[model samples]
Target: QTDQPVTFLLKDRAPATLSIAFGASILWLLIGLSSGIVSALRRATWIDKFSQGTALAGASLQIYFVGLVLQFILVDKLGWLSSPGYVSPNDYPMEWAQGMILPWITLGFLLSAIYARLTRAGMIEVMSEDYIRTARAKGLSTRRVNFKHVLRAAITPIITVFGLDLGALLGGAVITEYVFNIPGLGKLATEAVSNVDLPVIVGTVMVAAVFIVIANIVVDLVYMVLDPKVRLA
Candidate 1:
C-alpha cells in the first residue's frame, strides 16, 4: 500500500474543479441556447451569418490558445481580472467570480458554439413541422410559437449534447485547467500521468465515470419533463 490513499488526495481538489466546470457549463449552455434561438429566428440575415462565422471560428480554436488569449487580454493587458488561479468561493465569493470568468469563458466557448449551431438547426427543423404551421395559422403570437412550441420540441438533442458535455467537463477540462494553472481534476490527472501514479489515475477515471452516469440520469429525467410523449415504462 502507498503512503496516501487516492481518495484522500482527491478529496481536497475535486470540489473546486467540479465547481468551476459546472459553473462554466451552465454559462456555456445558456449562451449557446440564446444564440441558437436568435440565429434561427433571424435566418438568412446578417446576424445569422455573423453567428455562424463566429461559431465556426470558436469550434476551430483549441482551448489552450483561447485560454492564453483571454489571459493576455483580460488579465495582463486590461487588468480586469486576476491571472489564472483558483479562488475558494466560500471564502471569497466576489474574487472567485472574477477569477473564474475568463476560465469559464475559455472552457465554454467552443461548446457554446457547438450548442448554438445545433440549436439553430434543430429550431429551423422544428419550425417547419406541421404543428408549428397550425399554431401560426391559429393567430398565436410569434414569440409564443417560437419559445413555447418551437423550443420545446427542438430541445431534445440539445439536452443530450449538454448532458455528455457536462459529464466530460466534470471529468476534467484538461487544456483549460492546465493553461489556467488551476489544480482541478484534469490537471491532477495530468500530474498523475506524468508521475506514473496508477492509483490516482484510476481514482480519477472512476470518479469521472460516476459523474457521467449521474449526468445521463439527469438528462433522462429532463427529457421526460420536456417531452410528455416520453414515458418511463
Candidate 2:
C-alpha cells in the first residue's frame, strides 16, 4: 500500500482551485463591469477606445502567455511579487494574497474581455430603449435613469455570463493551475492524463460537471428574482 488515500489527494487540492477561481472572478467582474459601463457611457471617447482595445488584447492573449509574462514582470524583473506557488491563507494571509495575485490577474484579465464587451453592448442597447427615453422625459434624475432604469435592465445578461464563468473557473482552469503550480483539480486531471490514471480523470470530470450544473441552476434562480416576467411565468 502507498499509505496515501486517493481521497486525500482530492481533498487537499480542491481549495487551491476554489480560492483562485473565486478571487479571479471578483477581480474580473469588478474591472469588467466598471470599464464596460464607463465605455458605454462615454462612447467615442478615449476611455471607450481604450476599453475596447484592452478587451481585444485580453481576449487574444493565451493564458499561459499571460501567466508567464506576469510572472516575469512581477516576480522576476520587478521583484514586486513572490514566486508562483499556492500558499495557504490561514498560515500566511499576506503571502497567500501575494502568491495568488498573478494567477488571479492572468485569468481575470483574459475573462474580463468577454464581460467588458457584453456589458458595454448591453448597457448601450438598454439606454436606447423607449422606456429609457420615457424615464428621462418623466424628469428622473440622470443618475437614477442610468442606474435604476438602464443598469437594472442591462445587467441581466451580465449575471448569466457571470454564473457561467464562475462555474467554469471553479471546475478546472487547467492552464492556470499548471502555470501557478497550484495542485488543483485541473493539475490533477492533467497529471492523470500523463499517467493514464482513468479513475482520477473520471472523478475530476464528474466533480466539474456537477459544479457547472449547480452554477447554472443558481443562475436560473437569480433570473426569477431579477426579472419579474420570469417570476410571473
Candidate 3:
C-alpha cells in the first residue's frame, strides 16, 4: 500500500483550484442573474424567447462538449484566447485571467441556463402576487415596482439555487476542470479514482462537504437579509 496521505497530495494544489472555482462562481452568478432578469423583463417578446431557447440549448450540452466547442471557435478558429492551462494569479495576473476565461464560460453556461429559467419563473410568479398589484395600485413606477418589490421577492429561490450551485462548483467542477486541464480538486479526485487511491478520494469528499456546508450557512444569512420574514432562531 502507498504511504502517501491525501493531505500531502492536496497541500499545494488546493488553494489554486479553490481560487479558480471562486472566481468562476462569481462570474457565473453575474452572467446568470443578468440573463435571467433580462428574460423576465422582456417576457413574451422575441428577446425572452431567444433567451429561453438559448438557455435550453446550453443546458442540453455537456460541459466537456461546451468546453471543446468553445476551444475550437475561440482558440483554434479565432485565436482570441489561449488553450486551457493554469497560471498563478499572484505571479501572472493577466495570464491567469486569460487561462481561466474558457473554463469559467464552460462551467458557467449550464449554470446560467438554470438560473435564467429559475429567475424567469420566480419573477413571473412574484409579479402576479397581490403585493405587486398593490404596488402598481399605489402608482409606483414600473421600474420601481419591478426593481424594488418584484425582484426582491422573486430572488429568494434564485439565491437558494445559486447557493447550491456555487457549493457544487466549489466542490469542484469535475468535467470542466478536466477538460480545461486545471489541476484543481476535481482533477485530483479523478486521478485518485483512476489509481484507486482511497485516501485522496476521501479527502476530496471531505473538503467538498466542508465547502458545501459553508455555502449553505452563507446562503441562509443572505436569505434572512433579503426577506425579513426569515427568522433564524
Candidate 4:
C-alpha cells in the first residue's frame, strides 16, 4: 500500500522523537529558571527592561519567521549547520547540538520573558504582604527577607505557571523543533497531518494529554505541600 512506508516511519521515529522531547524540556527548564532568577534580581533595572523587551519580541515573532530567518542565515549563508532533519546524537552529537542551539535560545528566551514578567509581579506582591513586612521589621537581613519570605511566597504562582508551560512544551517543542528541523514530536505531528496518519496523531494527542494531566496533579500536590494554607483531600 502507498501508506505503508509512512506508517512504518511513524513506528520507528515516534519513540525517538519523544526521547528528544524529554531532553529538550530539561533545556527549557534550565533556560527559564536562570533567566527567571536574573529577572527577579533586577526587577526595576535596565537589565530587566532589556530582557523583558526581548521576551516581548520573542512573543511577537512568528515561529515560521524565526525558522525561516535561521534557515537562511545560519544554514544557508554561514553554513554552520546541515539541512534540517532529525539526527541521532550517537551519529552526530556535535552537528545536532550546533543545529539546535539557536532554536533553543530563541524559544527559551521567548518563554523566559513571559515567566520574568510573572516573577517580577509575584515578587512585588509578596514583598508587600504583612508576613514579609513582619520578617523585615524583626531585623532579618535583606537576603533573609527576600529569599525566605518573599521568594518562597512568590514562587507559588511561578510554580503554577511553570506546570502548565511544562505540560505544553512536553506535548511537543513545536515551533522550536520545526524551525530547527529537529526530528521532534512537532515535526511528526505535522507529517501525520499532511499524510492523515490517524494512529500517529492519536498517539501524539494522548501523549500530550498525559503530560498535561500529570503536570496539573503534580502542581497541586506541590502547592499544598509548600503552602500550609492550601488544604487538600
Candidate 5:
C-alpha cells in the first residue's frame, strides 16, 4: 500500500487539476464578463433578453448532463475525445484537450452565467444611482458615464461575489470532475470517499478549504480597493 502509485497519483492530482481549472475559469470569466458589459450597456433590448436567458439556461444545467451530452457528441458521434482517462501530450494533446474541453465548458459556463447575471444586475443598479445621473447631467458622454462612473463602481460587487464563487467552485468541482473523469482533485476526492482513504481525503479537504479561505481574504482586499468606505483595520 505504501508503494502504491495510487497514493502519489492522489497527491499530485489536486494541484494539476486546480491549475487547469483556474485557468479555464479565468478564461471563461473574462469572456463572460466582457459579454456582460455589452449586455449591461444594452439593457431592456433583445440582446439583454437573449444574454440573460442564455445565462439562465447555463446556470440551470447539471454538470453531469453537460458532460454526458458533450461526450456523446464528441466521443460517440464526432470521434474526438477518448473516454474517461488521461492521454499523454506526446501521444495525444489533441485528444487530451478534446477530453478536457467538455468538462471545462460544463464548469466554466455555469459560473460564467452566474457572473453575467450578477454583473448585469449590478450595472443596472449602479446606473440608476444619483451619482450616475449627475455624471450624465454634467454633460459627460454616454460612454464616459457608463464606463468611467457606472462600470467602475458596478464591477466592484461582481468582483466580491466572483471571488467567493470561484472559491466554492474550486472546492466543489468533485462531481463535475467525476462525471467527466478528469483525474482532478475532485475525482481524487470521490475515490477517497469510496475507499475511506482518511489521509488522502483529509489532505484534499484541507487544501480546498485553505484555497477558499485565501480567496475570501483576497476578496476582502479587493473590496477595500474598490470602495474607500471599506478601510482595512
Candidate 6:
C-alpha cells in the first residue's frame, strides 16, 4: 500500500520472512529428529508413546488456533512474552529472538509433528538393518551408533522433506506472519491481494518459487555429498 515499488517492498520484507523460516527450520528439525530418534530407539516405551501422542496433537491442531492459544497463555495470561511483532535482529538481537519465539513455536510445531512420524518410521527401518545390528555388535557406543551411523542413514528423507518445507516457508508463512503481526512476504502478499496489487502478489509468488527451486538444488547437493551412490543412481 505504501508508495514504494514492489521490488522495494519485497526487499524490505524479505529479511523477516527468511529469518522466521530459518528459525522454524531449526526448531522443527531439532524437535522432530530428536523425538523420532529417541522414540525409535525406545520403541514401545513411554517416551515413544508420549512422543506419538504429542505428534498427533500437533498435527491435528490448526495453525491459527495454536497461535491464539499461545498468545493467550504465554502473552496475555502469563504476561511473560511481549505481544508478537516483527523486530529486526540487526536492531536488537535479543528482542528479535524473543519476538520470534511465538511464531517459531507456532510454525515449527506442526511441521515437526509430521517430521517426527517420518523420522520415526525411517529410524525404525534403519535400526533393523543388518548394518545397524553389526554396528551394535561391534561394541560401538550408543551415542556413536545412534548419531554417527543410524541418524545419518535415517535422516536422508527428513532432509529432503525439510528442503521443500523450508522452501515453502521462505516463500511466506501467511497465517503465521498474520497472527504474529509480522510484515513478512506472506503479509505483503496478503495485503497485496486485499489491495489488488497484482505486481506484489506475482512478485511474492515468483520469489517463493525461486526459494523452493534453490532448496531442492541444495538437497540434491547434500545427497551427493552424503552418498556418492546418489550421484551415480
Winner by TM-score between candidate 6 and candidate 4: 6
The lDDT of model 5 is 0.75
Summed over model 5, clashes come to: 0
Steric overlap count per candidate: 0, 0, 0, 0, 0, 0
**103-164 per-residue lDDT for model 2 (tens digits):** 98888899999899998999999999999999899999999998887888988999999998
Q: In candidate 6, which residue pairs clash?
A: none
lDDT of 1 by residue, 44-81 (tens): 99999999999999889988888898899988899988
What's the residue-level lDDT of 37 in candidate 3?
89
| Model 3 agreement with the true structure over 1-233: per-residue lDDT tens digits | 24777677776567657766777778767777788888999999999999999889878988888889999999999999998788788899898889988887777776788888888888889888998999899999999998888888988988888788778777876787778888888888888899898888888899889888999999999988988779544
In order, the Cα lDDT scores of the candidates are 0.87, 0.88, 0.83, 0.70, 0.75, 0.91
Rank candidates by TM-score, best first.
1, 2, 6, 3, 5, 4
- Per residue, candidate 4 scores C-alpha lDDT tens digits across 2-64 of 355544655555544555445555665566555655666778688777767776786677767
Q: What's the residue-level lDDT of 41 in candidate 5?
A: 89
lDDT of 2 at 221: 94
- TM-scores, all candidates, are 0.95, 0.95, 0.94, 0.78, 0.84, 0.94
For each of the candidates, the C-alpha root-mean-square deviation to the true structure, in angstroms, is 1.5, 1.5, 1.7, 3.3, 2.9, 1.6
Candidate whose lDDT is highest? 6
Model 2 regions more than 4 Å off: 1-3
Candidate closer to the true structure by TM-score (higher is better), 1 or 3: 1
Clashing pairs in 5: none
Residue range with the least summed lDDT across 10 consecutive positions in model 5: 1-10
Q: Candidate 6, after superposition: displacement of residue 191 in Å? A: 1.5
Instruction: Evaluate model 1: give its TM-score.
Output: 0.95
